[model samples]
Target chain A: MSTLFSGQLLFAALVVGSIYVLIALGLNLVFGTMRLLDAAHGDIVMLGAYTSFWLFTLSGMSPLLSMLVAGALSAGFGAAIYYGLFRRLLANTQLSQRLEGNSLLLFFGISIILQNVAALCFDTTPRAYTYLDGIIRFGNVAMTGNRIAVLIIAAVLCAAAFLFLRFHIYGLAIKALIQHRQAAAVVGVNIERIQLLSFAIGFGLAGLAGSLLSMTEQITPFMGFPFTVAGFVTVILGGLGNLTRGMAAGMFLGFVEIYGVALTSPSLHSVLIYGVFIVVLFLQSQGLLGRRPS
Target chain B: MQPVPIRTSLIFVAVIGAASFLPQFGSEYVVAVALSFAMWVALAQSWTVLCGMTGYGSFGHAAFYGMGAYVQVLTWGTLSPWLSVPLAGLVSCLFALAAGYPALKVRGPYFVMLTFGLAEFLKFSIIGIEATLGQFSRLIIGAPSPNALYLAMLGLAAAATLITYVVSNSRFGYGLRAIREEEQAAETIGIPVARYKLTAFGLSAFIPGMVGAVMAMRLSYFEPSQAFDALISFNIVVMAMIGGSDDARGPLLGALFLIGLSELLWARAPQVYMIVLGALLVFFVLFAPQGLAKQLFGGARRRAT
Candidate 1:
């Protein structure tokens, strides 16, 4: 009985944590590499969920297939954003001057646009994949098959992303740009191309997370707002400019949220997550995994 | 020396005079919307102080505003909005002082992100506390007369404008401008960079906090979600950017224009309002980056040159 109970609790935490990790990883990649505070990251997650839902409902496609389609569509959208907005802004500007003033205004505007467009296209009704059903049980513990699948996918993606960043040429180029953009450009790195690829990959991950979330939970157009808060908190707790730290923080946050819900009201879960972030921020001004200020 | 533009003064006076009498002419709905606009203007001006002049873009003014509303609602209810509202502002200033101490150490996007995190933290805390306390949907305590609340808000708005005006001309303002221009240079020149930033942040929090209290009274309700809505923060930032960050009149004009536009758009096509707002922001950033205020006044500065 004890073993089963522990397993159930651990599985629950892992499942919740995986979703947060997926979202945080995307945000961390974007912020870490590009130094762009894309507030639209959460919206991308939201759009992905909606797209997947529509695909499943309208075309009767398998949820897994829809997830891939949604991710691809979101990646394309992210690339367009890079080309249309960020690239134009970065062109003819120095690196230090690139991140200030109007960039914030531009992204924020894009967020608003995406949010309203989602609302218009999909009415403000919460959606879910109803076909994916049947709870799987191991002794006293129980969870949906979809939840189990989501966990596996999340684990694979996390490992894949880590390996790619550590070993892949494109990932190395991204890291180079992040460390020093001008120097990277000086060394013959195509900074703009890397930026587009980085954004697409980051946003694509968010989309994939969104699709997974919709499998187990309901989706809403405005859900992006809460997720934005969550993603930022997770990334902050993990440390800026560190993907590994972000993943760890996401898992920690997931467990915290689950335990908080179990111990207290579910409503307080978000509050507890945020409270922990605040405490961590106070303790180390640079964040949990960030280096000391220069 | 030529008198400071009678045409501008006259226009201001006429606008204020007309606004003061609007409650009498309009229906309850119109009055409510106008009052909301007034609240937005106050909030935008508050944001402009830190973001526009001081070069610290706060992505969390709504937190301070929500704090002000919460403090007032928890303590005084809506019985005496005139007194309670300013108290809310005071509370917000104190909170800003405390939060800004550690946050202001970072610069650029980091500072903005920090503020955003703090705001989200505050919002979540409010919701969590409210849920357990069973006060999640509590309405504002007292049902004060709307007329009185309206007048009080107007007074608060005027006071906020005056404060901004004073800050724009004062030595502190000069220091803030110095810090905004170049923090390292300001530090080299013996200006207290951190202290000035904290003071500006506190003052920025003060106006929105007060306006929020007034809003609580006018609406006579308080919910965590509504109080700490991120949309409020977005709208204030947009309005401030659109109007002009540097001048006192900029935020006011921006707030009025955006609020008016929101009303018209919402009435015509509620779903598309966000899209229009988004497009407008992009347009302004790419084209009129200096804002409408600068565009109107900038030409004069050039002509004089």
Candidate 2:
């Protein structure tokens, strides 16, 4: 009990929570901007993990460099998906209003295709690469170098994205679109370009998270589903489309997960997290940070 | 709410009648395929009853299916499958009765995510329960023959379709559709919006529960993960979409087409089959969101209107 409540557990929770922030950010962005659920978000994460994994295994490139490459590639793929699939759906005026439901199914299909294709291409075996395996020790807590790297990189990526969304012209444009779609368009925002960009960035972030995740955990083709669920939970907890609040929610969930597992057992990890998900949904559908719609 | 056209009814009965004799003359492999066909038909039809009509699409039907399988497994020795199967349905119906109230409170995408999260929650909880009990997996020895299982699945398929048929034409289904089109309006018009949705959800759950029970015995294996596989839910939604969930006939057609396609490709190249299914889902949503059944029979309904 004492060890479970130690500084080590707290640090571990922060590390895991940082990863959640990465996953949720991308999810909320797409949902916020275009009202697309992006059910394939998890599969995009898997693609990123594979991208980093293969890059390391085949060419001995450091995962640190490959994470960026993975993010870039996934961004490209995301843009292509938008152009090929979602753009057409968005074009139909009748469909655009119901785009959330339509995109949910469309992305669900995309996820299935992505998962199966990855499984076929990579096989279902879990793969891992040896990175910085050495452990670093502080006064009382020891942490693996890989996990430490993951945390730092994830934090850096998240902060960069936060600043971009906060201060950049395009970031403000994206925020404007989310806040008022008609008004943003009336004010000269390029709905199509902004939508495409946001979609790509959302996917790219998931991909980047996957790469960082690959450093700390073994990567599998099917690994994205859990992250997808986690990301969605985080998104909901923070209130959809509220990025800063989502980050806080991710960390909060991370603490809850780690401490909950410590209190119970590791096998009950999913149960505890989903319990929180259900309770949050039932008790507060608007999310903890979201204001009730007038 | 009009009665199902006599032509559709005749076709349904004829196809089911032909399928009923399958176990008697068909090979074991044929029986197996037919069993899968029936299972999907049952699943897709029931899914249509609530999700298709009420427009409350669920990604959590797997929870009920898995629950049914779990119930059947628990009752395996004490009760015969004849008893266990209905018991599985009852258990799942009760689960829906309990879960539907809060679950139905959310609408659209929130409803979708909540249902999906609930299913995953149930899956993991079962996994934890099994782990705590020290039972990693359970094997059912001396399970029913494929022929028997096939018969049971075929019955469930027929029963599920019949239920959908009855519901789609009933006032209850009209209320459900009204809820779909506008829940607030439906309530204003004196429909018990909450009660209607909840009943439709529970009704939709019952058949899948039975199907899951029959499938568990057909495989003679039961594991929490396999029982609660999310792919099962995805497949059900895909079938419903492809078939057109507006009525019973659409899902029936969708099942036949996909099952036929799977029959051709699954054993030879399963990956290709999945890729094709995924591609079809995207294509249909993009090109023919009304579904194949609507394309074929949609004309008649429109003409009548």
Candidate 3:
């Protein structure tokens, strides 16, 4: 490929990778901290995209502002799901044994419901907006202003998340819960509040990523499925519950997919991404940065 | 040993007898639906043998099904359906054995994830091969007659049911159950946990492969997307879980229930069927974790009680 094409592809890869990093971060937080596998995380992402899309289309709001709205809404929805669905199931000892399987079916059903609702509302036609069509030129290479903005947002979010987790009281509480739920509870941590906050923030991150993705790509009801798979793969590659590792793995996957597409056919990008995942899993079952369970 | 209950024996006989004569009296459309339901029942039961009894949640069964479909397609073009279908099952069983060997080393969630990855990998490989090789020139497979296909499927389903019944009562079945309950304990008790798990996997794969082969023959077409769809795998698992994975009759009931539900919903409200199915799954996971079979069978009646 020419230098310009290569540069454009690299930039695209970074932007896409950043979105994955954002979503993976959220997934890692929820799954890592609560020890609950939320299969509906992708549906939350789709909700964010559709929410932003509708807002921009109906009220002439900027995508960035719409993203904030979407994030808040998703947080509310996440908390609601935790209270209404997960909490009840978590109470049952026999049910918890098959929680993963149950969660898969449960969230998958929710996903289908959300998708159908979107389809009924949006008419199943893929829609796009020209909110971020401007391009910034650097030498012979050109980059979309929207992409650059997304990269900046992603970087800021990642940095903010890292700082929050490392320094903040609530962040530490979340981590404490992840390490030892019983001990954290014994040490006067409100386990319920922490779980609610973590799930809300996790979903909020997914919503943010979804809004950013929609600015670059067309919005469809079924968009969540692929992104969910991508998020899952990233989490697995990064080591199940490690946030930093998930982000690193997401970026690694994004670059691999982008470069792999450029080198060969774009169709094989999934194969390449999943191929790396299988290899990583085979070699190190826990993943690159996943902690071994005691 | 407890004698086989007359009530249970009579129920089994009645169901089989009804199933055997279904094609003769049922309308063409009814027969078609019944055959389709039977096909899913077979696939679901196959999955139950491994996932329910052995505790190996193989998410890559679509790969085995796809392999069986392709094998049938490859053979039926040149050979007879009778010969090709069994060959498909054998091929799938071999593949399951090979794939399960490495996977059985891992336990719990890791095993599930690996199987999921393998299924996706197989889907990609099939699509890649189809793209690389011209679709028209690569393979030319003929379809079998629907009537013959229906009867063959019925026979296969019966055989699968019988095999499941035999295994559920056999020494091997006890070993499989032990592994499912506690792998370490089973190993300590000399249950050959790995071997029994592999055997379950192989049998599971074989049944689906055989059914998939018949399905391909009935459909008269085969493609990667159709053959290796993750949704098929999901549906089979859901059916087994819904009907009661632990019981032999559970998957069959689950399949029939889902098929009837899908057909009714699709006819009345095509868009809402999926939503309803999803809602039921979630509800069942939360409220009725034991599955329908457990509900029907009364949660394995304690002998003393």
Estimate the TM-score of every prediction. Answer: 0.89, 0.95, 0.94
lDDT of 3 by residue, A17-103 (tens): 998899888887877766666667787888898888889989999988999998999899889998998887667777667656556
Interface Cα RMSD, each model: 4.2, 3.1, 3.9
Q: Best by DockQ, which number? A: 2
Across residues B37-81, which tens digit of lDDT does each residue of candidate 1 receive? 777777777776677777878878889889988977887633465
lDDT of each: 0.78, 0.87, 0.79
Segments in model 1 whose C-alpha atoms lie over 4 Å from true places: A1-5, A92-104, A280-288, A292-294, B1-34, B75-80, B140-144, B299-305
Candidate 2 residue lDDT tens string, A1-294: 689868899999999999999999999999898888888899899999999999998999998999999999999999998998888988897677678888888888888899999989999899998899898899899998998998888888888998998899999999998888899999999999999999899999999999988888888878998888788788877887778899999999899999999888887888897898788777565444475211
Q: How many residue pairs clash in each candidate?
A: 0, 0, 1
lDDT for B212 in candidate 1 is 81
The per-prediction CA RMSD against the true structure, in angstroms, equals 3.7, 2.5, 2.9
For candidate 2, please provide the TM-score of chain A on its own: 0.96
Candidate 1 residue-wise lDDT, A1-294, digit = tens: 354347777898999899889888887777766676677778888998888788888988877888898889988988988888777666635422635445656777888888889889888888777755788998767888898989999999999998888899998887777677788899988977888888899899999988888888888888886677678778777776667878988898878777777777666766676677566656455543576212
DockQ of each: 0.46, 0.59, 0.54
Among all windows of 10 consecutive residues in model 1 chain B, the one with the lowest summed lDDT is B296-305
DockQ-based CAPRI category assigned to the predicted complex of candidate 2: medium
> Which is superior by DockQ, 1 or 2?
2
